[model samples]
Target: MPDLSTTYMGLRLKNPLIAGSSGLTGTRAGLLELQEGGVAAVVLKSIFEEEIAAEYDDALSEAARKGMSLESYDYYDYELRGAHVSQYVDFIREAKTAVSIPVIASVNCTYSHEWASFAKDIEAAGADGLELNMFFLPSDITRSSDEREKVYLQIVDRVLKQVRIPVALKISSSFSTLAQMIDRLSKTGIAALVLFNRFYSIDFDIEKMTVTGAGSLSSPAELAGPLRWVALMSRRVGCDLAASTGVHDGAGLIKMLLAGAKAVQASSAFYRNGAGSAGVMLKELSAWMDRHGFKAIADFRGNLSQAESVDPGVYERVQYMKHYAG
Candidate 1:
């Protein structure tokens, strides 16, 4: 059998498929299921920065209404925040004990605030690694790209100082200078970078004249953007790269590996299919490897990246001029 094992962020993985951070990885039961389903690792459901702040504010407001003492206010603040952080820490401990594969704790943050310090707790809780799902939507008309990009650096810097374990940054490809940003971040001492986080899309409810959420799950068609960037930047970046979004099966996984991704993260596939979908993809990958006479992941990984491709321009080509003109 081909050696399917690979390493990401300095941690060894039995295969390249990772259970991306989602509700499916929020509990011990879910972690065990994914392990049994044949995933090499699991990124625990992210602890949202905004959610913690919002909940803290609500609790403080209720305390004010009750005319609590200043000391009581402090108590409530510590207890509320601790409850959230402690629960996540406890989950990390439980996940580490419950599954043999790596447990990567995720933090979804928009700012470089006190929450970045929580990474230490996550690390102390026995997490194999940490993934910062950091993004700041470029929606503020007054804010320049440089300013927004600085926050991402600040968050990574803060968290890096707080823990010794390897860290991975999961970011969106929304930056104006996408390639430059990827290169800059890769030099930040991070172990890996996960390309393209899937943000919640909004859709119009024409009948109700209100906005609603678009499909939260990614479709297979969504893989091309990350694939192109991974192929373009993998050889150039300082750290390893993992492909995210649009990966739904073995073919998608294979495409990413060829594009030079060290690993592939998937969530929608499991939601649309089942947890066992990972095992199915692995089986397909192994069969394809056997037929190709490849004995290990390293034998073929990055074989088609732009740096190694015969027609490197194909990856950089934006227009379909050749196809249309031909």
Candidate 2:
């Protein structure tokens, strides 16, 4: 039998299949189904800073339209941030109480300051770990890359100081020097790193002249991006890597692990295939492993990473020109 179990961020997952934070992970019943589906662990849906602000804005607009009195509006517009966070913390407590596997709490942050102490609060609520989804938009053309990068480091510092629980960072592929950035981030006492957060893009309808959000799931071809990066950086970075995006099946999951990922976080596949899809993917991987004569994930994991490979140039940009020219 293949020993599919692997460790990530100090947590012993039954397999390296983490159900990433999404609508699928928001409910207790949903989380139970995922655990039952043979996943290693689950990252709860992120508590978004933008969402809290947006909700307050919607409520204020409604109240203003009704002409509410100034004295009646005594509280701050976004005071519900902690209240919502507390609710999520309660959810974690419940998840911890309900399951024997690891349960990670996620936070989607816009900046690197103040309320970062909330991470410690997550640990207190019985969360086994934390995944910081740092959202740094490159909207300010005037901002130097140094400034943008510093924010990430600052976030790591603040959160580390705030929480004793293991921390992992989920970042987008927007950095100018991604390899350097990953190396730097790994030095910050983090337990693991997830590749490429999927930001919801805005789409405009020409007929209505209005902007709307894009769909939640990733297209099949989309898997290539994270697959490529994981293969390239598998042996390069200091911390363990988890592949996210474009992973919709067992083949994709096996591909990610073969590329040296500690785990694969998926969303769209679950959305399309329903709750038990994760189980199907695991079964697929297990069957493939048996046929291939690999007895365990560790037997092949990181075989292609820069850390263990014979030709490191294969994962470096130095060979890209040759491939392009050929």
Candidate 3:
């Protein structure tokens, strides 16, 4: 059998398949299922910064309705942050105890604030690593691109300062200069970078005349974007690259590795096929590796990336050719 083990974000994975954060990985039972199904690591479902703030605001409104004093708002805010952090800390501790595979705590934060310090609590709770799901929609026309990019950098810097464990960033590809942004972020001392987060899109409900969700889950075709960027940036960036979004099967997993992703994170596949999807993908990868006469992941990984490919321009090509379009 080919050795599938690889290192991601400075942590050794039994294999390169990671169960990405989702409802499937939010609970102790879910973590065990992923481990039993053969995932090398698990990124716990992210604790959202907005969710905490929303909860705090709701609680304050309730307190006000009950005639709470004005001075109590500060206490309420502090306790609210603590309440969510305490629960997440316990979740991390329990997950660490239940499973031996690396438990990577995830935080979905829009800005670098008091919540960045919460990473320290997660680390102290025995999380092996942290993955920051950092992104903000660049819809504000008044904000310059540079100003928006600084938010991501500041959050990363603050979080890294608070935790000793490896930190990886899961980011969106929505940037004016994505390559430059990736280069700058990679130099900020992160252990790994997950290319492209799949965000919830808005869809119009024609019949109801209201907005609804648009394609909540990713299709295999979605892999092309990240695959291209990973192949282009894997060698150029200062940190390891992990591919996220649009990976649904073993072939997709293998392609990500070939494109130079040190690891591949799968969420929708697990949701569609259950935890066994990880095992299925690994089996397929191993069989492919054996057929190719490769003994380990590193032996063939990045073999097709832009840096190593003979036809490197294929990755750089953007415009659809008339010959192909026709």
Candidate 4:
């Protein structure tokens, strides 16, 4: 049997498969089930910045409708903010006590603000690390790309100052100079970078004439995007890389490792198969390693990365002119 243990973001994982943030990791029962299913770590469901902002807005709107005095409105805002922070702290504490595996707290935000102070409470609640799922939709026609990219750095700087634990940033692949952007983020004292966060897609309901979400889960075929970048940037970035989005099985997990990812996060695979899918993937990983005559994860990890490949240009090719025109 080959050794499956690997370290990610300074946390020692028994295996590389971490149960990524989702509803499945939102409670004690979910955490316990994932642990039993052999996941190395769990990133709790993200506390959304928009959700907190929305709650405050709704509270103020309701108070105004009731003709509440200004004093009462101020009190309601304070109370609502406290309630949200308290609930998240309690959840983190409970999860830490319930499982032996590392529990990483996650915050999904687009900008840096006072809400980042909550990271202090999360560290105090005993989270092993923090994963910031940050993306600024560059939808504003007036906002330059430089202005949009600065938000991520600003948020990370503020959050890192607030917490003592290791921090990782989960990002999307939408930047114009993706490699430069990622390298800049890696230099920000972060412990790891999770490649390619999955974003919600808008689909038109032709008959209803309304918009709906595209499928909420990633498909197996979705692995290619992260795979390419991980292989390309793994040798270039300043920090450890963890592959996210579209990793569905042991094969997907193996591909990520060979492509130079230190770890791989899976959510949709468990949704489609079950939490036990984690153990199944690990089993397959171990078997493959044995057949390849590898004794540990480090033995073959990054063996196929772009840095190590003779034909590295294959990873840089984006046009299909060669294949299609032929």
Candidate 5:
């Protein structure tokens, strides 16, 4: 059998497939299932600063609606925030004790002076690594793209300085010069970059004039967004590339590896096919590799990249002259 073992984010994984951060990976049982199912590594569910803050906001509003005393409101607000962070701390500890696989704790942050302290504490709590999910919302008209880019770089430097473990950034594809951003971010001494964390979108029920949350899952077609960039920048970037979103099967994993991805992270697929799907996926990949006579992942890794492929323009070309001809 070919060597499926590979290094990702400076950590060795049994294979190239990782269980991405999602609800399915939030518990000890789920983590064990995924690891047993053939995931090389697993990124725990992200602990969002904003989500923790929202608990406070919701408490305050509920207190007001109930006509509560100011004293009670203050007590609830303080208690909620502490409980949130403390729960995350406990989760990290339990998860570390539960599994031998690399447990990467995730944080969804914008720019927080508090994150440095949080990163230090998370590392202390037994997390093997940190995955920071960050992006500047385009809805902020006051901030220029350059300014937003500065925030991301600063965040990277701050957290990296605070943590001893390897750090990987889960970023949004919201930059004006994405190629430049990847190049600069890679130089920041991080271990890896997870392409494009999918943002949560909202939908409006126009009939009822109400707003609702969009579905959390990503479709298989969604992989194209991250796939293209992975192929283009994989060879040029400084650190390892991990493809995220829309990876549902063995074929998708093969495509990512060929595009120079060190590994692929999957989330939505487990929800669609259950945790055991990873086992099935690994078998399929091995079968395909055997049939193709490729002994290892490196044999054809990045074979489709612009720098490595015969038809370089196919990866970079946006317009076909055939379609534009008059």
Candidate 6:
């Protein structure tokens, strides 16, 4: 058998398949399942910053309505936030005890604030790594790209100052200067970068005349965008790159490694195919490696990246000129 072991974000993975954060990874049972199914690591379901803030606001309003004193209000506020943080910290501790694989705690945030301080609690709870699932929609037309990009840097700086474990930033490919933004972020003392987060999209309910969320699961067809970017940026960036958002099977996993991803993260695959999907994907990866006479992941990883490819322009080509002409 070909050696499937690889290192990602400075941690050794038995294989390159990671169980991405989702409902499936939010519980101790789910973490155990993924480990049994053969994933190398697991990114715990993200604790949302908005959810914590909203709960705090609601609690304070109820306290005020009850005529709580000002000092009591302050105490209530601290306790409310701590309650939320403590649950997540406790989850991390439980996951560490439940699984032998690396447990990566995820936090979804849009700004540099008190929530960033939760990184300290997470690190203290025995999380092996932290993934900041950071993004804010660029809907505000008045905000300059620089101004918007500054928030990402601020959040990263704040979180990095609070933790000793490796930090990974999972961001959407929404920046105006996408490559430049990625390059800048890769140098920010992060251990890895997960390319292209899949955000919830709005869909119109034609008959109801209301908005609803589109399907959250990613199709295999969704793999191209991140594959292109990983191939293009893998060699250029200072930190390791992990591919996410569209990897559903072994072929997709292989493409990412060939494009230089340190590892690949998948959530939809497990949701659609059960925890065994990770094992199947790894089986395919090992078989492919054996067929190619490769003994380890590094032997051919990045063999097809833009920096190494003979037809590098294929990645940069935005139009199907030849096909259309034919």
lDDT of 2 by residue, 58-161 (tens): 76777788898665444534356667778888988988887778999999988675558778779999999999999778999999999999999998899998
Clashes of 2: 0
Candidate 3 on 227-251: residue-level lDDT in tens? 9999999888899999999999999
Better of 2 and 4 by TM-score: 4
Where is model 3 more than 4 Å wrong at Cα?
A: 63-70, 324-326
The list of candidate 1 runs beyond 4 A from truth reads 66-75, 322-326
Clashing pairs in 4: none
Query: Lowest-scoring 10 consecutive residues by lDDT in candidate 1?
Result: 317-326
User: Which of candidates 1 and 2 reaches a greater lDDT?
Assistant: 1
Which candidate do you rate higher for lDDT, 2 or 3? 3
Q: Report the number of clashing residue pairs per model.
A: 0, 0, 0, 0, 0, 0
lDDT of 4 at 219: 96
How do the predictions measure up, each by TM-score?
Answer: 0.96, 0.89, 0.97, 0.96, 0.90, 0.97
lDDT of 4 by residue, 1-326 (tens): 88999999999998999999999999899999999999999999999878878888899999999998999977976788678888998999999999999999999985577778889988999999999999888788998899889988999999988988999999999998999999999999999999989988999999999999899999989999999999998878889999999999999999999999999999999889999989999999999998999999999889889999999898888887878458
- Superior candidate under lDDT, 2 versus 4: 4
How many Å off is the CA of 50 in candidate 1? 0.8
Q: Model 6: runs farther than 4 Å from truth?
A: 67-73, 322-325
**Against the true structure, candidate 6 has what lDDT?**
0.93
lDDT of 6 by residue, 132-240 (tens): 9998999999999999999999999999999999999999999999999999999999999999899999999999999999999999999999999999998899999
